[model samples]
Target: MRFIKLFCLLISCSFISPQISAQGNKNISATEKKILDQGLVDIQSVNPEILVELKYATPDNFMKKNVYGDLTHAYLQPEIAKRLSKASSLLKKAKPGYKLLVYDAARPNTAQYKLWDALDDLKIPARQKTQYVADPKIGSNHNFGCAIDLTVVDEKGNPLDMGTKYDFFGPLAYPRSEQEMLRQGKLTTKQIANRNILRMAMVHAGFTVNTTEWWHFDGMSKKQARAKYGMIK
Candidate 1:
């Protein structure tokens, strides 16, 4: 409950972001503007073809201390959206059944999106922060709209547990982590098998999995990853 509240606060403040520091927003290409005119930056409408999986969870361990809240369900910047469409289109082609699960959309409060400070409060070590902290200096890929945090869900809309909850910060959430499941022999092999289904799909879509966060994927396109990444001025 406490985590949820802080998570909400963070999202409410951070979701309406516009590259606070100017950063590289000024360089918006004419083509990018065309995408914006069509409302790529904002949620035009939920894609009916795509399944609606679990939305952002503030109470979740990785984001529990977040004061910036969740932006996955919020409005996106047009410049970023255009690129996302390109990324998503390719992803869908690579993995037909898989869909993008956007967790953090656009941060209205980029300041509150401090992974390091949040981890420190959670008692995570300094060295570990580098591995987890969404660096504000370079900014997160989520900020650029090229990256997304996502997982698979069943036809019933229930999240297929992939070892741990989405955004869970521990080793158990690692893609290749040997850590045991949370419950003592609760979920069966079949459930885990389903979870891996999503992982395999993501890999097929040219995404590189994060060793720590199973829900995370770095989109395969080098062009997208290299360009329009940092949002801070």
Candidate 2:
């Protein structure tokens, strides 16, 4: 009887070990693991109020394919994460029930290559593509975990209309063109106001706005990021 009980316990242990290993591996991708290993903190860990919907983790992005498999959480460098948390707090204070919704953060260089290739396959002109997607060779602030793509969401979790959708590659999405677009009736005043709310919170938290992409913000300049931390491989 004692031998039989021991055998049963061994069998259960063997099954449980593999299950645990598989669950841990499926929780995040290798690229994400590397990002975490490099000391990037998951944004939600710093501020649970900030919502995350990583576009690359789903097919809803401009790529139209899920590039970040099993990697749903948004990560950023420690200081950048703190700034984002501050931005989240600012939004809540300013708008009562609004929240900062993150779309992407701490992208790996490997993912950058995927985006670059996707643009090439789309036959986008070199100059036009660079405006939307950074050349992987040069690296983006995202590669160093200093950039984020985000928007504002109301109390009920609905994202505010920011003129164009996230990742829209056109003049309509350009911050510099917002006034012109509003004057031309392409963007409404309410939409511009919604964008300003998000901009104010982020800027107040010490983030630099990306002029061409309203949803994108950098915690620091590319040169600063490179000097502090090299691109995440």
Candidate 3:
């Protein structure tokens, strides 16, 4: 009778194991599962008001390739996610119907390598390439789940005119050159105001904007991030 009871228990366990596994992964892809495993929180889960449009997940980015397969959601460190949520709130309070639109976040080092390879194929010099995509060898703040690339969007979901497209790799995209670009008629006052709105929200929420990329912001310095968390492999 004991042997029969043990046999029944084993049969039940076999039936339950696959069900549990499938349930856990029902809506999550391998890449998302990995990011969650590394302790990154999904931004939408933190603040649904903040829109996510992962450019690398599609071919709309500068690379012009879909490097982030099955990774549509943006992920960030828990603290960083909270900061992003705060930024979203601030933007809503200031602009009423405006929302923060995320372009990219918490990139895997593997994706970084793919971006590097794409630039390499284009014959872009290594030094110049670093300005756009960080070298995978050293890793980026995104790899540490401490960075975000985002913009402001109106209630209609149309992105504000920030002078250039999200991934425009040129002087027009450089925040440092915004004044010069404006003086030279390359950027309009309204464009600079739009960019400033984004900066105000993010900077007030404890993020620092990148010098070259108006859309890029760091939740913490790279050195600080490296000390706090391991890079997302």
Query: Which candidate should be chosen as best, given TM-score against the real structure?
Result: 3
- The superposed Cα distance between candidate 1 and the true structure at residue 104, in angstroms, equals 3.3
TM-score of predicted model 2?
Answer: 0.87
| Candidates, ranked, TM-score | 3, 2, 1
Of candidates 3 and 2, the better by lDDT: 3
**How does each model score on lDDT?**
0.51, 0.89, 0.90
**Clashes in candidate 3: how many?**
0
What's model 2's lDDT at 195? Answer: 93
Task: State which candidate has the highest lDDT.
Answer: 3
Model 1 poorest ten-residue lDDT run: 17-26
Question: Over the full model, what C-alpha lDDT does candidate 1 score relative to the true structure?
Answer: 0.51
Global Cα lDDT for candidate 2: 0.89
| Clash tally, candidates in order | 17, 0, 0
Model 3 off-target regions past 4 Å?
1-26
